[model samples]
Target: MSLHVTNTLSGEREPFEPHDPDSVLLYYCGLTVYDPAHLGHARAWVHVDVMHRWLEHLGYDVRHVENFTDVNEKIVAEIGEKGDSEASIAREMIGATLQDMRSLNLKRAEVYPRVSEHVPEIIDLIERLIDRGYAYESEGSVYFDVTAFEEYGKLSNQRLDEIESQGDPDERSEKRHPADFALWKAGEAHPEEGESGGQTWESPWSEGRPGWHVECSAMSMTHLDESIDVHVGGQDLVFPHHENEIAQSEAATGEEFAKYWLHVRLLETGGEKMSSSLGNYFYVEDVVDAVGTDVVRMFLLSTAYNSRQAYGEDALEEATERWERLERAYERATAAIDGPDAATKVEDAELRETIEDAREAFVEGMNDDFNTREALAALLSIATAINRHLDAREAFDYRGLRRAVETLEELGGDVLGFSFGRADDADGRVELAGDLVDLLLEVREREREAGNYDRADALRDDLEALGVTVEDDAEGTSYRL
Candidate 1:
């Protein structure tokens, strides 16, 4: 089946057909660098990262761009708390956010365009909007004339008339409509100018920074083509942010802005959205520090990408257990392939059909909008099949074992981004076994010296049960299977 994604643009699930099959352009809203990124941030980016990986796995070249809003009111607030300049504080936070992204194992986008660095391009886009009559300058501020755009709320599926009633009152400016959003704001002139006024730049309107929505339009259009293949973010950005982007970008270029509008649902705890504004967010760093990156990443991808997921200690623990099961299955596969005679050889057509069916199910799950939960279930089935094959204890077929091994690596390593291997080198297996023996011997000797003979004997018997021969000599106790 062709890949299908639920598009927010049309409010329907549609087949994903790229403008060009060879390369796809994807843009996602990056973090605002004023505060530490939380679970909400990680969930959005993780789903986007998984999309990038899946597309590449299916042999499509993807150029992904995620932008950072480094210059904003929030950053100024953080700067005030730090007693430092905005630039200095923003610089510090940018570095820290990148580190947090790495902890989440999020893929580095082709470009990380920062709002501060792309001011000139932002101004240029505003000029285009103004020239096209989609925007106008009012009292040293540029606002997108929402009324000029006929399809203002088409992307969000909201009627203009319905929204206008609840729109912000245009008390400060000569806005034609209350729904008009700021493209640029005039930098405040006085009152602790450096701290309160915010970063400024020369523009047609006045010396000031680009508004939040405008920054994304300028950066996305500048790096990617005018019309991108995919535009993605959290579900929350669907209203004013994405709605405005569609208006400004499409109006400026007189073309479609993005073909697919994909939005990941929010990550919740106990069915409540994780938000920085409401003070219900857990930092990615704190999570990684608690359980390590692997568990956190695996758990994040264990659910359907677009579905709302609840995250907490219980979910993470379950993820850890699932990962351990995969790890043990891989180990058993490696150990069972001990020699030419010991391999998992599935020559029967029925058995091969089972494995192939699992593979097909896995691909279908991923192809159908990245349903990772279903894909993971298929993966668990593969692992179980491997365990059953090992238990049969027949002469293992190298061909069957190789196919199973490679399939697991493809699903776990490429799709899930895990590294599970049991052997290291040519003599690696023997070396590891020998090292384990030597360590056990040392512990046994220590136990004997400490007069804990019962525990030492128990350890010796356990090794014997595993087919390791034990002998006591003047040098020490030696064990071999």
Candidate 2:
């Protein structure tokens, strides 16, 4: 839990070794401006936002850069003879994306560089690759010779022999090897071939657009430094997209591209990844409207960033119930602290101890690879203690309750990026929570009967961490809220 991260490059939970002791250079791969952002995108945004907050909380000059791929063919597809230019389409979709980001309460990055704005830098970078003998020109375009970059597949753990064509089939004849990818694609020489031939830029190679992978490298290097502390994106990109990024970036700079590569796992429903092409994704704006931004954020944070999260009716419902529980506790504590029953003479050491322990446990969980699951459990423990104090005691410890509220706001609200105290009632609380507890109790009973006291105790401890208190009496096991 000492500031560790599960780095994709190393495949280990190692200490977060910063490239710079006083700062973190972070880049999150942003959306291509072809469609509105979705819950899948929201998952990454929430996690990256948490990372940014945690780093800034640690007192670092976090220079975060997120990119918008404004000049992709997908943008052209969306235009589709509507008399709308690719640029206009991109602008509209980018607006959609920013709307989602704002609604999700994501912190603004230091810069949101777009591919269109960085074309000069991208052209210069392609020139560097060619000069370094790592790229070549074909007809009027340029392609990175993957075979020349000795470390071509290091990031993806792929070998040149195992790799297939990195570009379109037509490019195979131009590419020396199947794995070579385009650095710049030439516009159609014949204007009759494509309507957007006029959109191409006048480059040293020819009038053309930057390839998908090179756009990120150029934008990142232009906005951030040549080398960065962390480069994060969804896991689905690790194969060809990220692999090509490392190849082209390191080849150009002759230095490491990123110190740690963090890839957030996919969000799925019914075992299929949430994808626009598949028509199986939820638009961010719709979800936020339906459930509210706070519940969506809470639901996303309930699972850690590195784990695959299921998105469905049940998950959303669970998140709603959990948020209500947390919010009700926070509301109760605040009310009790100022109520007439509050007394300066009242002292609750047990409650104070619980608050302090929860605070520490939250930090531990966050440090352990940003494990929000564990951190939420810790905060829920504090919630349970607050409820017990309010439900049982006539007088409240003002100072202790204040500290507890601050801890919740600081750790839960700030770090986890969840908005609490929305004042929702317990009507939405999980109706089947009792049945689930009974199931757990049955499992614990069997474990105890099998003489596995350690396992049974572990189960009890887990239940306690989640605000459930299990009691074994003379007749049977009973749990209290």
Candidate 3:
């Protein structure tokens, strides 16, 4: 089946078709480097990362670009208040963002263009807009003429007059219309805070920085194609940020800015939108620290991308349990494949059919608008089947069990971005300790068989002191840490 995605532009589920058949160009709006990234940012980036992985899995060469708004009013304000250089503040926060991305195991974008690096391109685009009458200069600032673009509000479904202007209220008098937004601000200082001279470049309008919206338009088009296959961000950016991007980019190029617009819905905490002002926002590092990266990624993907997800401890706890179950299933499958009697043939029709059905369902879920929630369910079903087979006393086909393990690794590890390493491998000592524990358990089994019950019990007590639990049953023995 072909892929389908719910395009925010048309508000419809459209079949996936890139401008080029061999490649897909995707641009995700990245963070403004004023603060560390939070869980909301994780939700958007991780979803797009999965989409990137899935497209590559489907044999499309994907060129992904995500930008950084390093030269913004907020960053400038931070510079002034903190008494740091613009680059210093931005660099620090960008480092934090990258660290958070690593923690979440996100695939790095092919291009990470920063606004400060794309000043020349931004100026060039604004120049074209001015020459084309899509924008005008006011004193020194350049404002996009919202009235000039006939389809200015098409993407956001708002009429031009109804849309309110963002940024400095003082600039309202200079705009042709109240809805018009800045293409370039006039001064080096933030109009409101009067924080000046941190990051400015030469421009026709003024020696000032690029506006928030124009930065994305410049960076994305410069890095990717004039027309990209997909432009993704949080749903909250639909209004001024994305809407202004469409207007300026299309106006300058006289072409469609992006073929498909995909927006992930806002992630809420305690039924409220996660925001710094409300003090309910949780950083990505904190979440990863609390529940782990895999659990955080799973929790984000557990819901539909375009649906609002409320963050709660219960949800995270559930994700942790689910992840543990999949991990255990993977380990069990690995052990079964390494068993002494395993062979390379599928003798059981039911088990073979179960694996095939799970694989098909996983693909079906991903094909249906990248519905990760459904895809994850299919993955869990596969793990369940594998566990059931592992528990069966029958001599399973080694190749069939190996195939199941490979499937899990591809879907769970590759597509879902799970690192299936030992859960306690953080300090690099867990693997050695695990091996030692395994050796002790083997020795204890020998003692039990030789009728040395007291010695075996003593060994078990020592193992418990080291935080290992031993369970013996018909399957022999198993240990957990």
Q: What is candidate 1's local distance difference test score?
A: 0.80
- Name the runs in model 1 displaced over 4 angstroms: 164-172, 188-196, 338-341, 344-351, 422-481
Model 3 is weakest, by summed lDDT over 10 consecutive residues, at 189-198
Residue-wise lDDT of candidate 2 within 292-389, one digit each (tens)? 88799889999999997999999999999988888888989989877888788888998999999998888898899888899899999999999988
lDDT of each: 0.80, 0.86, 0.86
Instruction: Write down the worst ten-residue block by lDDT for model 1.
Output: 164-173
Shift of residue 225 alpha carbon in model 3, Å: 1.3
Instruction: List residue ranges in candidate 3 displaced over 4 A.
Output: 80-83, 190-197, 422-481
In candidate 1, list every pair of residues with a backbone clash: 343-396, 343-397, 344-396, 344-397, 345-397
Backbone Cα, N, C clashes tallied per candidate? 5, 0, 1
Q: What tens-digit string does per-residue lDDT give for candidate 3 at 1-481? A: 8899999899999999999999999999999888888898899999999999999999999999999888876777776665467788898678678878877889889988888888999899999999999999998899998899999889999887688776689998898788888888876755244444567887876777678899898998899978999999999899888999999999999999999999999899887888766778899988888888889988999998998799998888989999988888888888888877687654656667788888899999999999999989988887788777867847876776777788888988899898875555654675788889989988998998999999999999998766676778798789755
State the displacement of the C-alpha of residue 85, model 2, in Å, after optimal TM-score superposition: 1.2
Query: 1 or 2: which has the higher lDDT?
Result: 2
Best by TM-score: 3
Superposition error at 184 for model 2 (Å): 0.4
